[model samples]
Every structure is written in structure tokens, then in C-alpha cells.
Target: MVTVPTRVRLGYAVGSFCTANFTTIPGLLLLIYMTNVLAVDPLLAGVVVFLPKAWDLVANTLVGQWSDRTVSRWGPRRPWLLGGAAILPIAFVVMFIGPPLTGVPAALFVGAAFLVAASGYALYEVPYKAMPAEMTHDYHERTSLLQWRMIFIAIGIGMSGILAPILAGDTVEGYRLMGLVFGVILLLAMLASFFGTANAPYTGQAEPEASLKAQLRAARTSKPFMWLLGLSSAQTLGAYVMLAGAPYFAAYTVGSTGATTTLFAALVGPMLVTMPLWVWLAKKLDKRGAMILSGVLFMTGAVAAVATPLFGPLYAHLVIVVVGVGYAGLQLLQFSMLADVIAYDGMVSGKRRGGVFTGLWTAVESAVAAFGATIYGATLAIGGFRESDPANPVTQPQSAEFAVLIGITVVPAAIILLGVLMTFKYDLTSAKMSQVSHDVT
Candidate 1:
């Protein structure tokens, strides 16, 4: 058994704090910012949200391929990691500054900022995801490693998920403060990983396939990769949609905007605390099977959460605990399973293009999440959510409340079901993983 040093694992997991912060801001808060601060139409805001991830899709693949072929002393992935870390915070602050301009001019600034921020994160995240396959061959070890990684991911989600809104308050000034403080947090986390993981052994590409076309071809031919690509993207889309619904659910359904952070704490805190239990479940059931079980659990929880309003005023938070448990399972297992698929690719293809695979994985994930914003914003627009004014607060209508409920409940439940079905095609059981790892080593 190859043991990954505890520091290396800790370093790698800390990087996820930055990734989670980047993901949380846009997923949870960005579109709302468009409606409230910029006075952009909800439909237009959705369009703005979806369009920039197009750039993110392109960047993930290009950078993934770039990392695979490059030869450097600092290592192909590390140099880009450090470079991206420095540039990302600048764009992070820009997204929240919500320039003094209004109408189309304001919309354009936020859109442009998202493009830059998403692009910067691609450089860091694709390489970061790729590193795990190279780090170890043990199947359960990958799960354990990723379990810690997901714990930090939850920590990021918890801190930023709840804190960003509190810090930003319901004002433009609060958001500006949020941008500066959280931007620093993001910069520090990424840099910590870059320096802290200095002792990690770098895996060089052994095969000669270097072109982007070649890399894409490699990913396309791998059946397991294709299966995981769809499954992971679907579940992530569901997760983001559910998160986007939280503020609305709090505002319209639960009747308190201040309940937003409490809802987030309910979701993330329980998920974080229960991660070790999910890890144990994955060890018992194997990653793919564990993910299937998590999907079912999440689907049921999401559906059940919809009815929490009938129970009482504050009952929604308690209902969210169920969703959080299932979410915890999915978060912990899916990434470990991806690591398995990457290992399988290295073995069957006789090449270790972990960077390209992870890149494409994240790229498609960005593209799918684009639709999550589209779904959230377009649905709210359909429900007649009045965009907030700079001078006055906004009240949501029945249409808005209805849209949020479905997005949180029915939509996520369905998306997760598809992800569970895709798992039937994901064939890496524990016994098989042993063979896959041996083939690579």
C-alpha cells in the first residue's frame, strides 16, 4: 500500500476551500445580484449567467490538454495552479463590486467579470482534480483522501455559503465588502495548496498523445469516462439548482430572508459532520453503489422537503437535514468514483492523461451548471419574480414561490435519478479496482 503523507492530503483538501467558495458565489448569489443590485430582468440575468460558462467549458478542456503535454521543473500542473491563484481573487472581487452603472452597462460588467473568474478557476480546479489519480492507487484511500477533500468543500460551503450573504447583507455595500474579504480568503487557500503540496510526486505523461483532439478522442473512447461525465454533471446540476432555490425558499416559503444562513448551516453543517459515516458506507458498498444509494436518498429527501411548510414555519430547516445527509453521500462518493474511472483510463489506454480527463469532466460540469442558473432564473421569471430595485426591496409572487419549490424538489429529484441510472454503467467495484491499479503501476 502506498501511503499519501498526511500533509499532502491536508494540502490538497485545503485547495477545495477556494474551489467551493468560487462555486458557491455564482451558484448561490450571482443571479440574485443581477436581479437585485443591477436591476437586470431575471430572464436576462439567467442568460448572462449561462453564457459565460461557455467560456469556462472551452477553458477547462484547453487548459487540461495544455497541462498534459507541458514539461516544466515547477511541474505542468503546479505552475498553472500558482498563476491561476494570483489572478482569480482580482476577478472574484469584481463579480461582487456590481459597478455603479445600471441597465445593460451593469449587466455587461458582471458578465465579463464571471468570464474572467470562471476562467481563472479552471486553471486551478482541472489540475487540482487531476492530481488525485496520480497521488495514489488504493481505491479506499482515494475515498478517504476525497472524504477529507469533501469535508473542506463543506467547510468552504458553510463559511461562504452562510457568511457571504451575512457579510453582504441586503445591500450593494455589503456585497462589495464580501467581494474583498472572500477574495482574500480564496487567494490564501489556493496559495496554501500550491506551496503545501510541494512534496507531492508529479506524474508525467508517459504516452505520446499530446494534441487536444487526441485527448478528446481518448476521453470519448473510454466508456466509463462517458458514463461518469454524464452522472456527475447531472447530480451537480441538481445540487446547484437546489442551492439556488434556498434563498427563494427562505424568502417566500419560510418568510424570512435572515433564515438564509440558518438554512445553509442546516445543509452544510450536517453534511460535513456526516462525511465520515458516508466514507464508511462507501467502503462497505463500493463507491458506485454508494453513490446510487445516495441519489435515491437525496431524491426522497428533496421530495419530502417540499412538504415541510405544511409541518410548521421553521420545519424547513429540519427537512433540509435529510437532503444534507444524502448530499453528503453524493459529495463524498462521486469524486472517489471519478478517481477510479481515471485510474481505469490510465490502465486501459496505456496512458496517464488524468489532467485531460479531469479537465473535460469539469468543463462539462460547468456547461451543465450553466443550465442550472438558466433553470433557476427562467423559472423565477416565469413565476413573476419582480426584480429588486436599487432604492426598494422586492416581494416575490405566487409564481416565484411555485417555481422555487419545483426547482428545489421535483427537478433535483429527477436529475439525481438519471445520475443513479448512469451508475449502472459505471463498472468499477472494489475487486475490479485492484486490477485497474495494478495495470497502471
Candidate 2:
């Protein structure tokens, strides 16, 4: 019954620039930056990427709990959003400022900057994710708001995915400029959200839980939330594996680094155009059905891409467009479902615990995303990937090229298919939500 204002929706959606840019750029390029630019071993590069984000397991939960208890004029969430806006950009810029060293030293420097950046990212993301449930109780309105968010996410992913590579080139200096450019973008987007939601409405804010353990205990009891978490974690992992392998797929598998931008463009273009169609489909199929269809599409693309060696770059780009279509739906529905679970919790339990649920959601999402990079890195290691720098470019072994193809294709396809199967466990239909609303109201 509640309809969010268009200005508020747009304000909230703009924050996706921060979320999408931070996650996509690193997942898409950081591993390559280490292996190809810094001359770090593939396995070591993966570890460096993984360890910093692993910290999110702790930081996100704490931030969530902290924000839940926060008493601020800016509201519980916006203060942290402001903090993250200021800090993350600086840390992000530092992440790719390009250390004057290589190997372990370079890895350590980048790792430290990333750890700070991860902390800053958690500051914003946990509370930001918690907002929609608090914003409105209407299920469809949440989806509407998130539709706007996904559009921005698509734009953010598209711009960064397409341009960051071009900006970073294959050299250290290029990466430095890319970092500065995106950092400013991150700052402006996050601040816009903080100010844009200045007059946003809140449906309700319940009393905070006694402790983090108690909050999480309450969250664990929600079957819908649990199932959603499992489903999203698996989906994120599979997607990021493909993302991590993208550069290698461009260079070695497609025989040109320029393909990275084109590949990402293919993957993001559909996300921009088809979001409304997916949202409409969800009305007919229900969110769960739409989710399954989207997963199938993603799996189909990934499976088809395995034959890229036979079909070549044009085929690779075409299939990636399929993956992009599915991905748009997946990204929109996952958080929309999370908002449903959070709203349901407030109704059933009489407490505002969105932060706890979102913290867990973000922690798992961040970790698994990083883990995807590690998985691809391990695959590259298995194929005996040779690390090199711009000064001394080296030809990759055929085995490494094979690893790139399989890592980007079969591994992701299989993992995403399993996620699709897990969707059956999610039983939070609109009918169920309508019944819950009737009972609560």
C-alpha cells in the first residue's frame, strides 16, 4: 500500500554506484593487476585478494549491530553511509595508487589498503542494505525501489567494467589514474545517497536487540532468510568466478586484451535494458519463478561459452549477453527478497533487526565474491599460469589458456546451476507475504 517517492528512490538507488564500482572493479581487474602488472604469482595474487575481504565476516556484523543501536539526527544508517563515503574513496584510491615494489611487498601494500577499504565499504553497505525493509512494508514497492537501484548498479558496473580496464591499460600508471577517477565517483555517489534520502519516510523502527548473538539467533530462525542467503551466496560465487576469469579470458582465450571491455559491455548492456521486463515477469511467474528462469539463462550462457575456443570472440560476446540478461534479474530479486525477509521479521518478532540479516548477507556476499577470485586463481595455478609485468610480457602456455576457458565457463555454469536448484527451497511467494501482511495488520 505504501509508495516511495521517486526522488527518494532515485536517491537511494544512486548508492549502487559505490557498491557496484567497489565490488566489480576489484573482482574484474585486481587479480589481473597483481598477476599481470605486479608480477605476483596467480596463487599468491588470489590470496591477497581474498584475505582482506575475509575481514568483512567480522566488520559487517559489527557495523550492522552498531547501526541498529545508533541514535543519530541523520538516522541510524546515514551516518555510517557518510563515514563510508569519505573513507572508502580514500582507501580505494590508495588501493591502486601503485606501490613502488613487486612480489610480496606489493601484495602486502595492496592488501593493507584493501583491508581498510573493505572496512570502509562495510561501514556503508550493511546499513544501506538494511534501509529498504525499514523504508516500506509493501513488497512490490521494495521491488520498485530496487528496480531503480539495479539500473544504477547496471550503469555503475557498465562504466567501471568497460572503462576501468581502458583507464588502467596494462601498466602501473594507468591503474593509478583509474583508482583516482573511480574514487571520486565513489565519494560523490555515496554522498548523494546520504543527502538524497534526507526526507525519506520510515514505516517503523522497532527496539534494538540485546546483543549481536541474540540478533543473529533471531535471524537464523527465519526460514525464508536462511534459504535466500544460501541461494544468493552460491549465485554470487559463481558470477564472480566468471568475473575473475574475464581478463584472462580476454587476453589468452580471445587473443586480445581489448575483449575485456567488449565482454563486460555485453554482460552489462542487457542489464540496462531488460530490468523492467524481468520485474514484470516476476509478477506473472512470482519472484522465485523469475529467479529460476534467470538462473537457467545464466547457466545456459556459461555452458555455451565453454566452446569459445571453437566459436571465437564474436560467439563469446553473444553468449555473454545471455548471461547479462539473467544477471540483471538475479541482482534485482536477491535484495528485493532480502527486504521481504526483513519486513517479515519485523512483523513476526516486533523488532528491527534488518541490520543483522544484512550484515550476514553482505559478509557472505563479500567473502564468496572474493572466494570466486581465489577459485579462478587456483584454476590458473593448476594450469601453471606465468606471471609477468609490462616490461617483460610473456606468452601464456596452452594449459593456462585452457584454464582460462574452463574457469570462465564450466566452473561458473556448474556452480550457478546448483544455485538454481536451491531456489526451490525458497517458498516466500507473494501469496505468503499477503497472508502475513493480513495477519500482522
Candidate 3:
């Protein structure tokens, strides 16, 4: 087994801090920013949230292909990491610094900014996700490395998820301040990853595939990867749907905006403390078994949360802690599984196509994350949610409050439950992976 340095593990994991902040804050706040602050209709706000990420379906793939063929002093991925560090923060700040406009015009402005931000994020994320497979060849080591990432993910999500809402509050100026503060944090995290991974190993040194089509064809033909993608994408969609609904659930069902912080703390706190436990679970059950257990845990929590109206906010918070336990497992295992697939591909095909695979993974993930917000927005619109500005604060109807409850609970639970079928279909095991590695060596 090849061992990775603590610095390399840390450098790579820190990049997740950037990813978690960008992904969580937007899914958490952007839709409400539109519906509440900009006075945009719920459905329109959902569209605005969803549309830009749709561009990522194409852009992330192209960036992945580009990074695969890139030759740089900084290496294939770091150059793009630097590019993202420079551009994404600017676009992110622009996304939330809601201009002096309302309705469709405001939606249009955010969408445009978000489009650019999505592109910038692709520049970083696709290549960043590809690195683990290249950094080390050991299957279990991939899990160990990603364990650090989950820790950072927890911290990053915890900090951003809890604080961003407080910083933004319910006004235009509040959002701008939130944007600037997080934007700086984003820049620093990205740069830290780029500089930190300066001396990491890169063992997957095969020549790049001739074209994106060829690389994607390779990924499509990999059964483990395809199954993993389907289930993982479903898991992402469910998690983000709940994330998008958190603020609404807190404000309407719990009757306290401050509950957002408490809820996030509940969700992320387990992730910090239980990552080692998840790593151990993966070892005992293998990645697929551990993932299935985690999904069940997540689904159970979501279902139990539906009773929050009966039990109150404390009940909702406690159930989410259960969800958080499952979330920690899902987050760690999915990427570790992906790393296994990528490494298998490198050994079997002898091509440097990790970027392409990761590109596809990140693209589907980003789009699904956005769609989670869109789905929640559509749910609110269906419940006849009223949009209003701070100047005219609107109290949501009973139906709207119910919509918040269901969106945060039932919708995600159902989505995650559906993903279990795909998880069952995934067949990669440690023995099989070990054979593949032995064959290659």
C-alpha cells in the first residue's frame, strides 16, 4: 500500500471547503433571496436557480476534457484550480450582491452571474475531483484520504450553512455583506488547496484519450461507474432538496429563523465527530454496504422529520442528527467509490481519463444540487407561497407552511428511498477491486 503524506491529504481536502461553501450557501439561500428579497415568484425563482447549472452539463464536461490534455508547470489540474480561485469568488459575490432590480430582471441578473460562477466552479471542481485516483493507487487509501475531505466538508458546511443565513438576514444590504465575507473565504480556501498539493504524487500517468466522446464512452461502458452515478446523483438531489428547504422550514414550521443555525449544527455536527466511524464502517461492510446503510439512515431521518409538526422543532433537530450520521457516510463513501472506479479504469484501460469521469460526476452533481432548489421552489409555488420584499414582509399561509414541511421531509425521503434500488445494483466489492489492482501491478 502506498501512503499519502498528511500535507497532501490536507491540501486536497481543503478544496472541499470551497466546494461545500459554494454548493451549500446557494442551495440554501439563493431561492429565498429571489422569492423574499427580490419579490420574484417562486416558480420563477426556481427557474433562475436551475437554469445556470444546466449550462454545467456541457461546460464541466468540456473543462474535464481540457484538463485531461493540459500540460502545465503546475500539472494538469492545479492550473485550472488557480483559474477557479481567481474567477469563482468574483462571480459568487456577484450572484448574491442582488442588484437594484426586481422580478424577472433581478432573476435574469442573478442567473447571468450564476452562469459565470458555474463555469468558474467547473474550472476547479472537475479536475479537483479527478485527483484522488491519481494521487494514490490504494483503494482503502482513497477512503482514508477522502475521510479528511469529509471532515473539511463538515466544517465548511457547518460554518457557511450556519453563519450565511445570519449574515444575510432578510434584507438586500445583508446579502451583499454575506456575499463579500464568503467570497473572501472561498478565495483563501481554493488557493490553499492549489499551493498545498504542490508536491503530491500522480501515479496515473497514461496518455489522455483522443476526445471527450471517447472518454465519456469509456465511462458509460463502466458498469460500476454508471450505477454509482445514478444512485449518487439521486442522493445529491435529495440532500440538496432538504438543504434548499431548511430556511423555509425553520422560518415557517419552526417559527424561528434562528432555528436554521440550530438545524445546520445538528446536520453537520455528526459529520465532524463520526467521520472516523464511517471510515471504519466502510472497511467492515465495504463501500456499497456502508453506503446503503447510510442511505437508509438518511431516509429514516427524513421520514421522522415529517412528524415535526407533532413533536416540535427539537424533534426536527434530533431527527436531522440521524440524517447527519447517514449524510457523513454517504458523503465519504460515494467519492471513495468513485475513486475506486477511476482507478479501475486507469488500470484496465491505461488511459488518463479520470478527469472525464469526474467531470461527468461533478456536472450531474452540480445540476442536481441546483434542481433541488428548483424542486423546493416549485413546491412552494404549488402551495401558493406569496413573494414579498423586506419593505412588505409577508406571512406565509398554512398551505405554504405545509409545503415547507413536506419539501424538507417527504420529498427528500422519497427521493433517497428511490436511490436505494440503484445502490443495490452497484456490485463493486473490495475483493474485486483488489484483484483488479493485482492484475495491473
TM-score list, all predictions: 0.96, 0.99, 0.99
Write the number of the candidate with greater lDDT, choosing between 1 and 2. 2
Model 3 earns a TM-score of 0.99
Ten contiguous residues minimizing lDDT sum, candidate 3: 95-104
Name the regions of candidate 3 deviating beyond 4 angstroms.
none
Candidate 1: give the clashing pairs: 168-174, 383-399
Per-residue lDDT tens digits for candidate 3, residues 1-441, read: 678899999998999989999999999999999989999999999988888999988999999999999999888989999989889999999988865999889999999999999999999999999999988888899999999999999999997889999999989999999999999999999999999999989887889999999999998999999999999999999999999999998989888989999999999999999999999999999888899999999999999999998999889899999999999999999999999998888889999999999999999999999999999999999998999999988878889898999999999999999887689999888899888878887
Name the lDDT value of residue 135 in candidate 3: 88
State the lDDT of candidate 1 residue by residue for 1-441, as single tens digits: 566889998998999988789888788888777788778888888888888887777899888888877677767677778878977899989887865876678788989988898889898999888888777767788888888899899999998779998997767898899999999999999999998788886443456365788878988988878888888888998888887777777777777878889988988877778988888888888787788888888888788777866885567877687778888898888788888888777777777677788888888888677768888888888888888756977666777788878777888888888888988888778888787667656
